[model samples]
Target: MNRRLFLAAFPAVLAAGCGFKLRRFEDIPFASLYIDAPHGGAVAQRIRSALTSSKQTRLAASAGEAEAVLVLGPEARSKVILSLSGAGRVTEYRLGLQLTYRISDKDGRTLAAAEVIELSRDITYDDTQVLAKAAEEQLLYRDMEDSAARRIMRRLQSIGPGPAS
Candidate 1:
């Protein structure tokens, strides 16, 4: 194909390809959006890392630069069966992890209400064998937290300051 023909077809090919679009949570940084939580834990750390600009603080403090706040609620609960022996007796144990979270605006308006995000994953009775499963569970938990954070971000974006004139 000649250069002229290639160039002419390139535009069409690009157009035919999947039309990509990007969405941003907000025009302003997260630091500009204030956040408050009951506890400053791992999830809180992740939230700070993911935010555009973050100021880690407890629930009591007020965010002067922020327009919103995120308040974490009660922890969620769940159970997971570890293992079963051939004799039918419960050889292994069980474990669970709980999650609770919430988000709101600085005006005390609940932009995103509080809710629980709980998960249950298993580990075998054997010490070495259980390590892999534990790792997997950790990954799964991380993913869950990431997903929840993204959801909150999207929600905040939806409730944005309105279209820029």
Candidate 2:
């Protein structure tokens, strides 16, 4: 029993000695931030929900009221046929989501340069399961949006406050 216990705990002890730690959410620097994106957009909505849950930065109702403004460029989504069946039917498709964003202070000084985050997922398709495949495509797009939101949050955490004007 003692040997079995030691063996079970050995990995944990080794990890602790090596300082292995799980990643935790880092706080955003701004007290409040305004997101400039189209209303009811998927990525924007995900970002807003995340920030609200984090409670690190308040979401400003307007750009004028925030310490910093995050401007999101138009979101573009695409679906391309990556592979086709021998009969020329669609066998697989690659779905993509692209979004560009920049951060600036209330004074309009750029804090972070405009950057694009693009994500794609390849999905197999079968004509017999049209409804299921369509549902899968939507789920993939939603997953991509969630990932983009996390990336945006990380980018925001990396931005330090700009010099006082």
Candidate 3:
């Protein structure tokens, strides 16, 4: 019994000894930020939530007071039919999200060039399970938003202590 317990704990001990740590929000460059985006936008909300969750960041009241400002421009969502059944019923769909983002300093100096991030997923659909499929699609979009938020955080984290302007 003791041998079995030791065997189960051995791998964990080795992993800990190897200095493995869960990913965390690194010390991002700017301490405060302002987000410029349309109201009720899903992507913007996700990004805002992510930035606020980090203990090192503060949401500025305006662009003038911020060390870094994130400008979120046009965003789009599209569902494209990827496959159809024999009766011409949709069997698969590709849900896509396109978001354009850029970051600048309080002095209006561009810190990061404008870039577009596109995320898409192929989902199998069944006409018989419309309700379940709809729920699945919503979940997928939320997952994509979370992923995009994480990607944006990485971009910010990549900027070390640098000149604000």
Candidate 4:
């Protein structure tokens, strides 16, 4: 029992000693923000999840009620053939997601103008594994959405909470 306990604690101690820690989002100046994305927007949903994780930020009831407004444009997703077999069957494809957004004050003054973030992943597909490839594609899309949201958060952090003059 003692040996098992020490074994479990060893890695934790090493990580602590080496200063290994999880990445933490930077502090934002605003306490609340409104996400102005259309319903069923995947990128918006991901951004909302990230903001909710941070106790410092909260979603306002409406754009007018928030100190800051994040305007999210439509998200576009595409799959392009990256490679084809001699028989003209797609062997590899590049899956992509593009998201656009802007930040502004409640008064409609733009802080960060329209910015687009894109993410892509190359996947090899096999006709024999259609179901598996479909699942993989779904996972890739989810990853892209999460990545795009994180990028937007980093951009916002860099711009700070100050309004653009």
- Assess each prediction's global lDDT (C-alpha) against the native: 0.56, 0.90, 0.84, 0.87
User: Candidate 1: where are CA atoms >4 Å away?
Assistant: 1-16, 20-31, 38-40, 53-61, 74-79, 82-85, 89-97, 119-128, 161-165
For residue 61, what is the lDDT in candidate 2? 90
Residue 18 of candidate 1: its Cα lDDT? 70
Flag the better candidate by TM-score, 1 or 2: 2
User: Which pairs clash in model 3?
Assistant: none
Cα deviation of 157, candidate 4, in Å: 1.8
Locate the minimum summed-lDDT window of 10 residues in model 4: 156-165
TM-score between candidate 4 and the true structure: 0.89
| Residue lDDT tens for model 4, 4-120 | 999999999999999897987776667789999989998888778778888788889898888789999888999999999999999999999988899998888887899888889
Candidate 3 yields a Cα-based lDDT of 0.84
Top candidate when judged by lDDT against the true structure: 2
Better of 3 and 4 by lDDT: 4
TM-scores for all candidates: the values are 0.57, 0.84, 0.88, 0.89
Q: In angstroms, give how far residue 21 of model 4 lies from its true place.
A: 2.2
Stretches > 4 Å off in candidate 2: 1-24
| Model 3 spans > 4 angstroms off | 160-165
Model 3: per-residue Cα lDDT over 78-149, one tens digit each: 899999999999999999888888888888888888889999999999989999999999998888877777
**Colliding pairs, model 2:** none
lDDT of 1 at 123: 42
Compose the digit string of candidate 1's lDDT tens values, residues 60-137. Answer: 346545556666554443545567778765545544556666655565666566666655545455545667766765
